[model samples]
Target: MSSLGGQPILILKEGSQRTRGRDAQSGNIAAAKAVASAVRTTLGPKGMDKMLVDTIGDVVITNDGVTILKEMDIEHPAAKMMVEIAKTQDDEVGDGTTSAVVIAGELLKRAEDLLDQDVHPTVIAHGYRIAADKAQDILNEIAIDIKPDDIEMLKKLAETAMTGKGAEAAKEKLTELVVKAVTMVADADGTVDTEYVKVEKRVGGSIEDSEIVEGMIIDKERVHPAMPRIVKDAKILLLNAAVEFKKTEVDAEISITSPDQLQMFLDEEERMIRGIVDKIVASGANVLFCQKGIDDIAQHYLAKAGILAVRRVKKSDMEKLARATGAAIVSSIDAIAPEELGKAGTVEEKKVSGEEMIFVTECENPKAVSIIIRGGTEHVVDELDRAIEDALRVVSVAVEDKKFVAGGGAPEIELSLRLREYAATVGGRAQLAIEAFANALEIIPRTLAENAGLDPIDMLVALRASHEKGGANAKYMGLDVFNAASGDMLKAGVVEPLRVKTQAVSSAAEAAIMILRIDDVIAASKSSAPAPGAEDMGDMGGMGGMPPM
Candidate 1:
């Protein structure tokens, strides 16, 4: 209150909080760095796995960056942005999630130092943008051309993706499986889709037991025990019609006045069921897969006709079956024709792990395939599934892009060198940010070295010097995580899809720049209900309504 203008004004709410300027920038940077550090150790060949137990006590064990970040329960807003970077990387390229997040964290760390020097956040962000673009150029220059027929290179790409995870022990076998799966699903246009390669996991067997099926495997059992267990030279029918009697949408009751009338009704029902069965048999289909339910009466008739039938098949499985078996799904039994039936060499019901499942196998050049993953335990099976998924995705991406780069941190070190040289041409305050970005790119090779129990500084220095002397071919010079020394990654048969590295760098830079731009943080108070005894509480007088104080 002023002496002459004796009045007071209250603007903000009582419980609101606001942080501005440097305090806000530092808080955001710290939270983002914390998130990055959380996933830091889970990178490269010697990286460790994380065993995350959810609130309900379900456990997940893997070193996959996206999986670990997704399992983490983050509350800080800036930290959540860091998690989004991993998500974006996973969605776009399916690998290098840890590299992206770690680079972003290191970028923020460098920006903090620049901030201390009175450089504006915008300038730092601008320099990062420039560095990221230039890094992509350097990557493109160093990337080697790979074709879909490059079987050896693709296998190395797959192996590089699975090196650190649970599948590392079986990398040799899994690498072949992944490459085969991708090659089988690739179209003539060189477009490879990972979806056509289905992965199914079951326990009680070793990882070596995992193999890709030339055909699809339906998890459902045969509809009737009386049906044939196996049908060789099978002519399969895919139907969407329900074999059971249709229920009337409007309720109606018919009073049967006499036994004759009731007998006639039952006879008509039997005749209708028999007619439907006869229609299917006339189509010359020895096997039936239905998307809807099959009545017991229908099953009995099908069994009598020497046809194998499975009911309640999933729609996705039905589509896959159609692709694998060369079949057309018919809507009505009356429309079933000989040409509509799908051909399979053998349709059989086999018991696996004490559960009955149907395998539709041996189609000529089938487009859809399956990989049945077997493991000795549930956890092992789950982790193996994740590892194989990463491998398949990486291989598919490699084929789709038809390009690859040397792995083991070769591309990162080379990009760092090129970026620093480019930064000199950009000489300004932004140059400082560009150099910072160059340093951030080195974290990948550095992390690889650190995880391998080597001196990161010495390794990085050696790697840089190698690139400086070796020139263009030095793109293959990177950390040798296994031997704790620098080696030629290309000669070691370690490589990755170029898209993974490019996407990681761009996405990391975007996330760091976004987080650095936030200068004010205003948080509204959470709304809470008043206590039971204080429901009638109201604003008290300024002085407790005293006349004088």
Candidate 2:
């Protein structure tokens, strides 16, 4: 609002609220820090799990960072941005979400101190840019080369990912299976897709009961009781079209004046249904997976023909079967061919947990596979599923990138040490920002030590001393959380994909810089709009002044 010649000029609407300058910066930073703190303890091999209950009283228990953050109800804009970084980190590298969020929070915390010292937010942002770039370089420099054939190394990476997730009961078995699943589906050029590896869970047995299948498992049973439950040397057919006779989509009436006329119509319908069953028999497909329903008559004929069929299969399951059995989906029954039919060693229907499920197993060199995850309870199964997924994602990432860095806070310490040296040479007000960035990196090691029930200062001092030894091996030295001592991570088999660290640092810095650059926040109220002609009601003094002007 402004005044000229004793008259007021109102600009904004009546209910808008605005905060500018230092107040806005502090509020945003504080909100972001709260988000980070919420997921802070869910870090490292000794990290604790979080049981988050929602408004409806549904409980989620896990140590995964992205899961915890996503389940929260966030309203503040800046806090939502913090959640976004965790999502980005999870989407890109599939791990290190907690590390990314925690680092971002610490950066803001340090920058808040600098702001109190009267340093400009722009200067802090600029210093963070320089520091983030240097940190990425340091990460790549300290990383060691890996290869797709590094099976032992890949398993180690998977093990490191699942250590704290309560899947330790079968971590070793799951690690081996995770690596095998990834490598089996991985292309020769190093592309790995999780879509090809499905995780199916059930509550009945121990997690150790989980096993990998060589092909897809459909959650469906045979459409006919008269059909054979098992077919060996199965030639499978995938159909998208319905086996039922086509009916008029619009309303119509059929007039029958004589019994002979009705008999003729019934015969023709019988012939049409028989013709559809004949097509399947002609194709030599003993096993059928249909995307649409099969008529009752067609099922009877199919059963007589010694064919096992499942009707109304989902389209997604159809695509997976196509990949698993090397079958081409036939859109029309007339287009079916023997060569287009997929081959499986055996197709069988078996009852599991009181429900019938079909298993298509033993395809020669199958491209798609399934892992049946079994647990004694629902919550255990859920946790195991999460752990296996994280392990699978990390192993695949390592295979594609063929590079790894030491875990257990090794890279963070190395970056903290190296960045401090770089900051000294870049001496200025911006130097303070670079130093702040370095301190933020320490949060990882510090948190790891604290979670492990060790004195953070003592462990950090020992960790820095180990890195200060000034050798190639010194760079790989890190805190060993299990042993509660400093050790070389390379020999300890604590390792992670290089992309995880690089992506975390880069994203955390971007979020920090974005939050720092904001000096104003304007929130408009959720009130209804004014009348259509209200803008022109200028200087109408009282309630009785203007009438539809």
Candidate 3:
């Protein structure tokens, strides 16, 4: 041990000749592992909830790994890196934040043991990378191919993800809706893009019983008492600008000496407003999508003249509707009657369950996509939103790459078996890394079994033995193993281990090797006094841009 300035330095007697600070590497590794273990139990649907309380006693309970890790008030620099990994995983996959943290923790634990044996950080990194590569190969072999008609399977997959979220039934229903919505949006080219589907929820009624309106919904009251309540064969106009007259504030007094002056002002205002409405009707538009406020009198007049109106449209939705309808969005009433009002399309509503799902499909428009989500109690709706976001990510990945695997804890179990087989062939330090990786993969199924009050060790042993006997992989308690593709029974109480193990091994290996290359963490030194216009000094570090801890 020696001193480099004020920092204590540790000089290894072997391996690379580079000198390093004593606490830097080890401290970071320890911190990363600690953070990872914190979120480990919050893995699958049965995952335990983490209650995060801030200094003010504001409490937040969630099973969302990224949310939990992000809200956690961590002080250690190493732990922060682990949190970054979770964030990256959340951003990329929209799921797996928990898995990433768990894998990082496991890897760091193994690294700590290797360091104890003087294996060196560089060597541990090398071995981990090799093991990860082998694990990924196993993952690729186990991904079950998905088909367009596998709606029930998709529901099962989603249910596996949403079981403990108080929306098991909702998840199934929403999954079906999502599948149908995506399929409907698939163009003549046999491809489905997210742009073609739009899903929305409002507070007026149950989302389950909601209807898919051919046109957009506007939460507004009739502009005038005399305006028609409903307009048929409505030619809609989508206006991005204000429909009211502009005004400037000024101190003034009005003298009502005669009714003639009042009548003149009133006439002028009415003429201007009616002129705007007339122009819209003249441009082959019988309806209006107002992004801004509309005068009650103007709305009434439009309604009286048989023009339909929808007000307070969101800018984003307004643009989308405009694109879908091929209607021009005008900035002012003067521009309302442009020759490009596009064509008016039919709007209808369909009811499903007890929720309302609004579907807007434009005749010749290119942008098309559907949003299917669950709703119930307030918390249920919030959780459903989170689930929908995750579902969207998964769907996007599936549509884009044309492949995916069963999620939940299934993949982790599958990966372990694959890694174990690969570890048997690799010798030296690399073999140790592979064995560690395999053990890490087993954590999920082990947790699942333990959570179900079964002896995890016994279940694992039985699972392995059954697989060795040429039995199928999946085994639910007291259930027969049925073929995943066909209804035929493959074996009693036995399921294929390889399929589940493959996903776990692949995702783990990919994530682990991705995080192990970092060799430095840097922080900028602050000057005693600030320079003119200089910003505050900040810390900078790197863990090779790896996923969370």
CA lDDT of each prediction against the hidden true structure:
0.89, 0.91, 0.57
lDDT of 1 by residue, 218-244 (tens): 899988888899999999999999876
Counting clashing residue pairs in each candidate, in order, gives: 0, 0, 43
Superior candidate under lDDT, 1 versus 3: 1
Q: Over all chains combined, what TM-score does candidate 2 have?
A: 0.94
Q: Give the range where candidate 2 is weakest over 10 consecutive residues by summed lDDT.
A: 540-549
Cα error, residue 511 of model 1, in Å, equals 0.6
List candidate 3 stretches off by more than 4 Å: 1-22, 53-60, 169-171, 186-233, 244-272, 293-297, 322-376, 406-410, 424-428, 470-549
Candidate 3 C-alpha lDDT tens digits along 20-138: 34355666666777887788777655567777888998776677778888889898766777777777765655566676677777777666676677665666666667776766665
Q: What is the lDDT of residue 168 in candidate 1?
A: 71
Q: lDDT per residue, candidate 2, 268-288, as tens digits?
A: 898998998898899899999
Between which residue pairs do clashes occur in model 2?
none
TM-score of 3: 0.71
Best by lDDT: 2
